[model samples]
Target chain A: MAQIRCTDLTLAYDGVTVADGIDFTVNAGDYLCIVGENGSGKSTLVRALLGLKAPTSGSITFGDGLTAKEIGYLPQQTEIQRDFPASVREVVLSGCIGRFGHSLFYTKLQKDLAAYHMERMGIADLAKKCYRELSGGQQQRVRLARALCATGKLLLLDEPTAGLDPIVSRELYSLIEHLHKTEKITVVMVSHDLEAVMHDASHILHLKKKQLFFGTREEYLDSEIGKTFLGGAGNA
Target chain B: MLEMVFEMFTYPFMLRALGVGVLVSLCAALLGVSLVLKRYSMIGDGLSHVGFGALAIAAVANLSPLKVAIPIVVIAAFFLLRLSENSRLKGDSAIAVISTSALALGVLVISVGGGVNTDLNSYMFGSIYAMSGEDVTLSLILSAVVLFLFLLFYTRIFAVTFDESFARASGVRVGLYNMLIAALTAVTIVLGMRMMGAMLISALIIFPALTSMRVFKTFRGVVISSAAVAVICFVVGITLSYLLDAPGGASVVLTNLAAMLLFSLIGMVRKS
Candidate 1:
């Protein structure tokens, strides 16, 4: 079943339309990578899908018992945000706030879930360490653990490997690949890593300022636009 | 020295001032962790200037300053939050524009209302015995309100302060919590300016949070440490001021400065 569907979606800012007439459907357990050039509205579309902003027009529908609020998100980090004063454990546990509902406390299950995700991300040893003191790769892992605690159904990552070394990026990708395959969590990622993501993603969303591409990986590879963009080898 | 301090508290007004000071300091610390984390700590300073302007207006209109300043500064806090998020006017620039203007407006209002009055100096710089019975009652009630809301939304506030966009993406009502912080801090700012004066109120908010963050690695730890630090500084500052004949507001701010310096030294030494 489709986990999320966007129909004729239009996103704009300050009365200027960025992307319009967009249609895409992400199926259950599918890893979808949203790719685009710098100015291409990938971030805007993510914001719309996450309900952070109202679509200029059109709608996004969710299925498979998934709601917008239940979707986990790992946002791109800024320098100031990176320097925030918080422990790795506290950062991960905060992801439970959405499910915390009206209660002012974290349940044992929530704490256990946070602990589980931290262990899964291999950062359980750094749980008590300050988040700001971690390396970029370690910080991203902590953020991933935090997002995992937010929801188990769907995880949306925005440029998760933006500022890491190539080796660390590959390691992070492997971790994400493991999560996608083993945890069966539907993944929607906006990333600039064309070659790295294609091998892992089940579907590709190639967005241009005026064009939109959404299909299975093979179909996307076979498409003329993909051929032209990738010069016939998306692996490159 | 201890007996001298005990004897000063024997007076009803001194006890009243101490009670209100303690309440305001605790509330400021609770609100401060988020404000400092959000980099909105100066909002207290900005709102206090607005409160100062409102206080002058209240005096001119012959109304209670607390009644007048509370609503005005609360509204100003909302505006400040909106302005802070506005791209063209973000962070300290927005605060500088609003706060300096309000400060000038305060002076103008005071002059236009016929020069500096007898209580104006007390309001601007704070006096230990300046808190009246009515002011004490309002302080207790408003402090309770601020403390209760802070506790009620502690987790949500933590989420919002840490990463606003991510928190919003995960279904936390980011705007509502921002407003809650602004409102609570506004009330605390107004109460604090009356008890510790405008110039020192921001110190109460920023110092405790910064000092706590120096020692604590987690949000909850910082918050608990901030409250403790704020109360201790306030008490120690008050005692020192009484003993040495110093200004109460400056005394508290200096104590906060000392605490920040001490904690930063410890942090550096530990890191090394």
Candidate 2:
């Protein structure tokens, strides 16, 4: 059974239709990559998936006992974070905020979860360090650890390596790949890194203001849209 | 200096002002950390301006200023939120427009009604004599409520301030928390405006947070230090006001400015 399924999803904001007729499903443990050009509604689709924005039409449903809150999310860095005053551990612990629901403080279980994720992400040593003082790659690791604290079932990443050196980006990608392979966690990533996507993803969903293609990675490589995107602008 | 300080505390009005000042300073400092982080620092200034307009109306009608200002300022805060979120006005511009208009309306009303009495001057510049016994009690209660709500939602506010999208994705009600911060800010502004003055009340919300951020590397450190900075500044400012017979609000603002400069110097020295 699919962990998440979207049917004929149409997303529009500010009276403008950014994308329409989007249909896809993620089976448990599937590695899905959403790819698109700029202004192609890729981020919008991510928002819709995360339940941050409502679709103008169609339905998104979770199966296999998956709830929306159970999805771990690693969003792109925002301007506020560039100078934010927060310890690494404090940020990671915030991810467990959803687990308890309106509780005043984190429990020992949540703290333990955060600590474990930090250790796994290779950021346990940086736990007491200020977040703003960390390097770009380390900050992403902190955020990835924070996301891991939210859920263990599935992970959604939107441009997780948006602004990092190539070596750092590769390291993050490998770390995510390691988590996916070892933990049996379903992964949905939005990315502009076509080479990485081709190498890492099991499935591809291409968007160009609409659903251009949705299929397995091999199938996507053979599809006309994927061939054009990969052969023309994408690094083949 | 010790005897003079001890003597200043003996007066009932000084004691009342001190009590209200401490609570307001604590509340402002707590909420200020989030507001400054979220870049909503000017909301305090904007709401205080709205409070000024409301106070002008209250004074003209012989009603309690707090009674009239609280709801209006809160509504203005919500309006600022909505305007920034939905309208083309954006954040800082919306604040500028609304706040200036409110300030103008206050000045116009004050000029038209009574030709600028000492009562009106006190609201604009803030005098220690401005706080009455009833006003002190009301201010203390409202300040306590502000402090309580801020503490209750501290974690969520930190999450929201740090990252709104992640907070929303984590199933945190980002909009609801944003509204909570705005409303609490509104109440704090109205409560402090009587003593801090409408023009300078925002200093209470901005200076301590910025000062603390200069030296503190973590949010918890900044928050704790911000509260301490605010209280110490308020105490010193009020003392200077009593000694030099300066305006209470101006004294406090200058003290905060000095603290900010001092912290920045310390931060730079530590870096070197």
How many residue pairs of model 2 clash at the backbone? Answer: 0
TM-score for each model: 0.96, 0.97
lDDT of 2 by residue, B9-88 (tens): 99988898888888889888988998899777777888888999999988877787788888998899898877665643
lDDT of 1 by residue, A1-236 (tens): 68999988888999899988789899889999998888899989989989987988889999999999989999998655676888999899999988976788888999999999999999999999999989999999999999999888999999999999999999999999999999899999999877888889999988876446888889988988877877745556
Q: Over 4 Å off in model 2, which ranges?
A: B86-89, B115-119
Tens-digit per-residue lDDT, A10-101, candidate 2: 99999799999999999998999999989999999989988888999999999987888889999889888999999999999999878867
Task: Write out the backbone clash pairs for model 2.
Answer: none
Each candidate: fraction of true contacts kept? 0.77, 0.77
Q: For candidate 1, lDDT tens digit of each residue in B1-272?
A: 87998898888977887888999999989888888877777678889889888888887777888889999999999998888776524666878888888888877877778743536777788888778888788779988898788887777887888888888988888998899889888988887787788777888899999998887877888999999999999999988988998999999999999999999998888889
lDDT of each: 0.87, 0.89
Model 2 chain A weakest 10-residue run by lDDT: A227-236
